[model samples]
Target: MKLISSCWIVDPSTFEDHVALLSSARALKFEQHCPLEVIILSGFNELQLDYVEELKALNVNLNDCTDITRELFLEYRHLMQDINDYEFLCFIRWIVISRFLVNEDYVHIDADLHMQINSSDFLKLFKGLTGTFGSPCLVAEHGGDWFQAYCHYFTMLINDKSGLLQLLGDTEISLIRTNIVSDQDLINSLEKNNRLPTLLSSFNLENWSVFINPLWPYITKPSSPVGFSQNGPIDLIGGKPVLFWHLQNDFVSFLGRYYLLVDLLGSLGDEDLVVKIPKLPIPYLQMDCSLANIIFRTLDGLYRHSRSGSSRDRHKTYDPLSRLSVTQRFIHSHKGREVFSERLWWENSVFLPLNDLT
Candidate 1:
């Protein structure tokens, strides 16, 4: 069968088993349905520890990789290796090169995302796009700058991959020194070379169409099909996303934004009680469950219900089948509420478009 346009890249750290478990779950789910290839460029630590064998059983092909290129502070000997790793996804243009095998357009989902999407549904979306999955396109969204978008966009599609190559410019070799000592050095070099996203505005919406699709990797909310958004969640030809970003560390900065949204949604309370996301699962990448609570009552609002002051009657929603009875009822009550997307990254693969979100 011809390959589909979907692939994933994940850096699995050993300490972050939850993240690994999530990534493995994703690889398992996607490999079965999407007919797409998934690539994992993670460290050897996970492999040396035997967790990778479990991961391998999930149909993942592990490429030995490092979080930081060089270990010691001495001279940067692995700078080239480091640069190669940094520019890892730059190869979206060539679909034939993947070991996962494919002849169509694709998306690279981060391991952190916890989507409830059926991989088959996404495959259908690509079938409509009519390009090889790995093909590139330019997409516009409400985020920092093109570079950041470019990273995710690289997995999505627009027009011609070659066109994208020309527009984004070729990857610079000197730019990637394998012997690089620190992540900072690699980041600084790229930022200086203008290879990274421009900091002028994280909100700078572009029209040029970098890599298409995967607009927001973790977020399920939709961007209009026509062009740049003048509004929010305005569904177009495809459908509005039920998903949202589930970022971990950034929570400290995002709390007030959600509060503002809550107040706005509550003010409009009628049928739409402002949705409340449940407490987000701790990001295993940054924190272990030992220190990280399985559930945080903070503003992350992942599994949390969105409560609108306007709606006198509580709305129905869904929680994992794992919850207790009272918790189950509580989970069912928060429908139509918006959840923060940044917190529940890993769940995207297994729990996309929760039956409730649908």
Candidate 2:
């Protein structure tokens, strides 16, 4: 199977895209040992040479999608007047995928995803599944009475690219042009009308437990352990290990915390500043310094903002300082909404005791 990630680098500041593509490729090649082709679609000319070299070092097949992206923007620019380049790429990616990998079995993970588990072992669980499979985005209640379900494109297993293209063809594009909806919104509409051929799968395992005790705003503790085992970074769901974390909108913040933690550890000399959580293999930063306080406070702010109100409300109240963690934040933010789990925080956090935070 081929593992694909698509990113259109219109801005050089979008470092999370590079991190996502590189880290996932590394995970697939080094950690999972999965015999799958890793393909990346991005504007190669726009990417940094060092970043491109790192991907090449990992044996990633980089496909330059600049020409295709330009053509797509030219044709759809008028219809996509309100949409930005990033959002526009979301719709264009499917067209690119359909044309590029026809009749091929592939998993198209969003560029913001961070993968940990073995691909072969994870894909084995979906052996009997037919047609295309996507992670469950929004449930019936949140989407209204007429809504069936919406599948997130974050982690999609495309066994039938042709069938998927049918859903994204001229008719659907025309509908999108009329309504001016997001790719996910259009997908939800198709799902509501029973037009999608794909199955909505909860691949994220959002309700499943993580080893850490559930932090507030979030009530339940599902039992998945996440930490650096002697083998490497380990994350589990339903007592079974799985593949990838879709950090979604929290990726930039998560990456920021990671780099900040790295810098803090370096500055603190890593001797007495690190502490270990019980039953977890990795050491965490001690919550004593000003920097540590900043981390936790930012985390708390994220929880508050996410739990505040509706999607639009959350967007309006989005705290730039509050976007630091992914695992706990992702779980809590979607508490009453969609279920999308991610462990990027566990991979990068300073491991604060949840009970200690107010």
Task: List all candidate RMSDs to the true structure.
Answer: 14.9, 13.2
Q: Model 2 — TM-score against the truth?
A: 0.50
lDDT of 1 at 96: 22
RMSD of 1: 14.9
lDDT (C-alpha, whole model) for all candidates: 0.33, 0.43
What candidate 1 gets wrong by more than 4 Å, as runs, is: 1-37, 42-50, 56-105, 128-358
TM-score: model 1 vs. ground truth:
0.33
Clash count list over all predictions = 73, 5
lDDT of 2: 0.43
Candidate 1 lDDT over 1-358, as tens digits, reads 2222222234443234323333434423545434333343334454444655555555444443233222321222232243353343333312222323233234434433323344565343323232111212211112223334343434322334345445444443233443223333333334444555332233212321222122232223333212221123321112333331222223322332334334444555733433343334433333444443333334225433554233454233321221221121212232212332323222333222333233
> Over the stretch 1-358, how does candidate 2's per-residue lDDT look in tens digits?
4555565654655443334455555545433244333333455676678877677677565677667667767776565566776666766666665556665545555544444555565555444332233222211111111122222331221233345445544444342254434666556445444555443443333533222112211113324422321122444433334344455443334433443443345555774322321121112333346665666566656555655688666544423323323332332222111111232233323222333221
* Cα deviation of 294, candidate 1, in Å: 25
